[model samples]
Target chain A: MGEPLLVQSPGVPGSPVVTVAPGWAFAAVAVLGALVVVAAMLDGALSARSAGGPAGGAARPFGEVARLMRQRRRTTVQADSLLWRIGGAGLLVAAALMVAVVPLGRWTIFDLDVGVMWFNAMDVMVWALVWLTGWGANSAYSLVGGYRFLAHGLGYELPLMFALVAPAIAAQSLNVGKVAAAQEGLWFAVWMPVAFLVYLLGVAAFSVWGPFAPALGSDVAGGVRAELSGVDRLVFEAGRYALLAAGAAFSVPMFLGGGAGPVLPDWAWVLLKTLAVLWLLVWLRRRLPAFRPDMFLEVGWLVLLPAVLVQDLLVAVLAVWRT
Target chain B: MDMSPGGIPLAEGGEDRDGLQLDVLKVRLGPVLPHWPAGLVLHCALQGDVVTEVRAEVLDAGDEGRDDADALARALDNLVSVLALAGWEGAAAQARRIRDAALETGDRPEDLEGLERLRRRVRRSWTLRWSLRGLRPLTEEEVRHHGLPPDAVGDTYDRLIRMMDRAATGTRQDDRPVFRVEHLALLVIGLDLAAARLVLASLDVHELQADHTQHEVAHG
Candidate 1:
């Protein structure tokens, strides 16, 4: 529902591209999003409440997390304590900023010339910082986690990079806005369905928000996060959510045609589409079985990588025919 | 020494002298580490835990003026260590009462509260030792024991067991619940063998007489 907020009869006349004021739009959306998150927390609390006690659900986690924060932070294992402090904080900051860069509705830091490249930069930053954290811990599980991250990153990355580029080839501009706009009348899904499928698959693997959730698994070297505790654990969990937010952000423009709706404003349409995709990610986590790392790597290399490459060819053919 | 039939003279030659029969000794317990508060002085009489005859003393730690009463209290309390041979209960009580009277005579709340609490605690130790003849010492053979040095404590053990007997089984000589070795050691250290043995018999430790002889044989 991409409806106009304040429609002007002939306001510079190209799809009536109305501008939202600087900071005002962001200030409003942040307030609304925070309220939504609060509501979601309350909803989650009510569902988890038990019959025996006062039903401290949200309150319990909040108090527990707060208490852990206050508790003396001591690393029992002999490791560089300084690195644990630094890298853990550094990854949290990186992930938070990456989340901020994505469009919540139509408001983002910028929909830059290389908006798609922005996500890749953020993705690379996360893994690097994560590796630092895992290694700094100087633990067996942490080392295994760092290695698994590298392995999984290598496996999922090729397909994801192709999927990101496939849409760019279809739109013929590196800009996410233009690519999203190209899918306006007929979503690129019609012509490049395999590429769309591959992109979704790639986001799941690379974003750390899917059944490709290798690092958080209880088994398999515990996926790099088995050794984290207290604030370290908190920062990691927050980073995961931030990355999940980024994944939802990427999916909007790729499959759903970023902010393309009839009634709502462009940013609102962007928000609606992004939230829908994020909810699906949550649903998949709830419903689907986890993917084995080797099996996923096989699919990524043998299957998805080839599919996006073919979609890139098809999009090129379609562009040539249109010209 | 008037050797009365019971071995201890009842009234020092039966002279109910038409005058105050007061005896006093001052005992200073410490250059006590900071954990053990300084200025803990006890003044007591030679009577018993019941304080049948009494007067007491203490010294001010930081007094530059050197008030006569404070000096006398210190002198008395200092003399209390030598009086330990006389008795801790008497010397402690005499030193405590003297400190109490001197501190109470002062208007300071800080000095009074701390000094008085120390006084009460020392008296409680005497009273506790009094009650503990059959109560079992923390030392000795781990059964019946005593508190303080043998030269320091008095014959409070016999009085304590007798009090317990009168209260519990209605006879001081009743040998039902016997005391143990710890209790005996405490009584020995408290320097009152007669009272200590009485407490032992009350624990029914008469049963261990054979074991005692065997131990004596091994040690001897």
Candidate 2:
């Protein structure tokens, strides 16, 4: 028989909160970073293959990193180097902070009361982080790319926040661990399809990878990150993939019943689910086209917002009925 | 809004539809843009990311090549850039692969088959059509007067379809290049930078290389 899960605090009975050694937190971050790198490598190969170029192969992403590292740093005249550096590094920091709350099996660094809100706040931070990187460059194209990201942010943020509400409401707690625990019997995703769909959209938007990638769109010549070169480009690229990986990992707890699976350790289940979600998000890029900001705004406000609200309403009613 | 040292209006102050004062900033796209046609520059006066005034010009006259193989290679290059802008990396890569194979091996059967499959997939993509449909619709007069290739005489979608068809067939039939340098400035004037890029890509504005040579010939 497995030992009873250790509770961090004694105040609440039957709470899903668990405590782990401090070393595990660092190990989790390292593992997540590796997963992100793998996802990015796969993404590069996928993009290359799709474009009819030679497949990036196993070593292409690694080779790209080396090439970028050796390239000399290029700077614009009158550019705010300080702000630009901050903006470049901020993405990785934001991703790390967001991922900190995500549970790996029964362990998380901080199982806070408002993990859902924390995740939302970190994503919103990405909006500012991208704009700052663009504006800091003082180049017209980069600045415009920054503006595009903000426009995209306006379209996706509210609906994304609304989608987050469904899981929190069903669990009757804002804590992510509790939400995952609530799904032990039946996953919320099975019932809350609309919210799940909107959440996926939100994931794409925050990561700026697939259809929602207007900020870094090629139309603006690489958008907000257009001016980046050398180490700056490398760090930013890593940060982007990390953010994407974190988004997919967070989805596991919120909708996919977290670590709950048959015949596998909780950590293994979390890893498997995270990989599945990450693969899905990356695959979608080739399947969909980037949406025009104006079109996306209209859809976000008119369609996605209303649809997620109704999903939230239904979840609320169902929660009450079950109670 | 500020004036430059040369007495040029660096940032023009303007009023929006809501009567709010807007700061117009001058931004340049390309001559150095990624996934953009090489040696093309766009000067834009933007009022809150909307292009209120725009100008297009060629910075460098490209290498002149008119052979059938070069033409196909150039067409594939254009296809690559356009697909990149559309964010269709898979199809764009396929085009590149076929183009490379055609040039290196002289239209191998396998490469042609791959190109055919790619054409079907791109043509069948509703997402591609949704992204491209009705954008930069051309009047029959404009298309004819420009001497555009017969297949390229419609919207961006039509041009893309034509490009795909030629790519699949590995055709050697010379389609008259229909690019007028002045039309670029005209077409991009009111469009936002993103739409402007799509229009330029669809037109394969690089085909204006021929027009540039003609201009140089007249001047020389």
Candidate 3:
């Protein structure tokens, strides 16, 4: 809200953030791509270690990309090709949109007044995009996978929305930058641990990562992606990791102290924090089992929802008392 | 309506568990699936994701001779499927490593030690316990009626732990009844697709014998 800081020098900022021109979105996207690649490599290495194989597995993403790019497209008899392709490609686009408002140290692409709400909207789009991807395939397993995601969405979306509210209430602003700056002395994650944990769980849910991956469960023969192959499958898989990376990046402003580390530039701190969170999410995939939708529904509503709501109430009370 | 859209028949409307009319899609879960039984197939009439009706059969079932040396490895292989289906990739991969070592070296001392560690890991996982708890519990009467092994007497989580113990101690039950393919339909009737798959994997069905009469078993 204060001076846009369009041409402020790095490491000597007054407002701590500047609104960059839209042309720099490409650079933002490139950063997201790098994070995705790092996440995939970490996952591959972990998989290899678990299987007692050689470290050469870290190069698997490159091999997979090359193979999928070269392979022919697969189709079903009654496949809705149009909607299917949109669903497959929309995730990366949504992830790109999510990171647009997330300021990297002292710069952001689109520094909207309501950046937090923009992120929430982008995440909600995942519910539709994933379902469409499932519905477009025209396979029974794919349809089931699609419905499974919706079921998970039902349980997690409300809690996630509430979790987002906690930071906004404490910051007294919907702007993501303000939320990050509000934690001048202490990060919101420290005071609101429950909301932070729930936010992470929601990110995992939206990205279809780790325990929230029943929609892509192998029991249903890859579930929603059962029939996807070649370039289409490649894009869909890349989009998932991109979303995870983007979610981690956004957490910098909303939960972690955005670019608030010493001995490093703000942007460098942002990137380092993003990479650390990204690696943690990737590593967790092997540690937990899939949360079957039926059992998880009860837990989401009864445990997570109430717990996050309490965290929000306590945050609101503190904000009021401080004012 | 027998109309075929793009060479695929449209699903018909049917009553679901809640008495609401829903489209019933005839889906098949199979012999070719990643974690499914080798020769078993279930032609399911699904209302949404729930299996409204199911008919299971085994294809090309015969007495494939067993190797006594790799019995422990075979148990570990089944354990791998159960863990993978439960969506714990790390434990599944660890189980696979032990199974591969058992296969290659005939249960050497190191393999036994690995099995013990894997067993302890699986036992200690509370998340795994929570995910699999109370899923498709088989009572003693149900187990005896379906010709299930004595080890299948508990719920899915219990069966999982029992499987680990069996693999670790090398307790091969030689006189167990041949699990007929017909029993699969009865076991998975009212459950949804994911639960059905987990229940099937938890059954520890090592071998399935074909029902020569080709009888259809239907349930709602």
Highest lDDT scorer: 3
Better TM-score candidate (1, 2): 2
Better of 1 and 2 by DockQ: 2
Task: State how far residue B165 of model 1 sits from its true place (Å).
Answer: 76
> TM-scores across all candidates?
0.50, 0.89, 0.94
Evaluated with TM-score, which candidate comes out highest?
3
Which regions of candidate 3 fall more than 4 Å away from where they truly are?
A: A1-16, B108-111, B208-220
Judge the docking of candidate 2 as incorrect, acceptable, medium or high: acceptable
Model 2 bad stretches (over 4 Å): A1-7, A10-14, A21-24, A51-56, B1-10, B16-19, B29-40, B59-63, B108-111, B142-153, B170-179, B215-220
| Residue B10 C-alpha lDDT in model 1 | 35
Q: List chain A TM-scores, every candidate, in order.
A: 0.78, 0.94, 0.95
**Per-residue lDDT of model 2, residues A146-202, tens digit only:** 877788889999999999999999999888889898997788888898998898888
Write the residue-wise lDDT of candidate 2 on B20-98 in tens digits: 8987788777787665677777787887667777777777665665766676777777777777777776676677787
Worst 10 residues of 2 chain B by lDDT: B1-10
Q: Extract clashing residue pairs from model 3.
A: none
Q: Interface RMSD (C-alpha) of each candidate? A: 37.2, 3.4, 0.9
- How far residue A218's Cα lies from its native spot in candidate 1, in Å, is 1.7
Q: Which lDDT value does model 1 have at B57? A: 21
Q: Write the per-residue lDDT of candidate 1 for residues B23-77, one digit (tens) a residue.
A: 2212222233211224322222221111122121222333234454444343333
Candidate 3, residues B37-115, lDDT tens digits: the string is: 7778899999989998889877764545567556777788889999998889999999898888887777643446577
Instruction: Give a tens-digit lDDT track for model 3, residues A80-147.
Output: 99999999999999999999989998788876777899999999999999999999999998999998
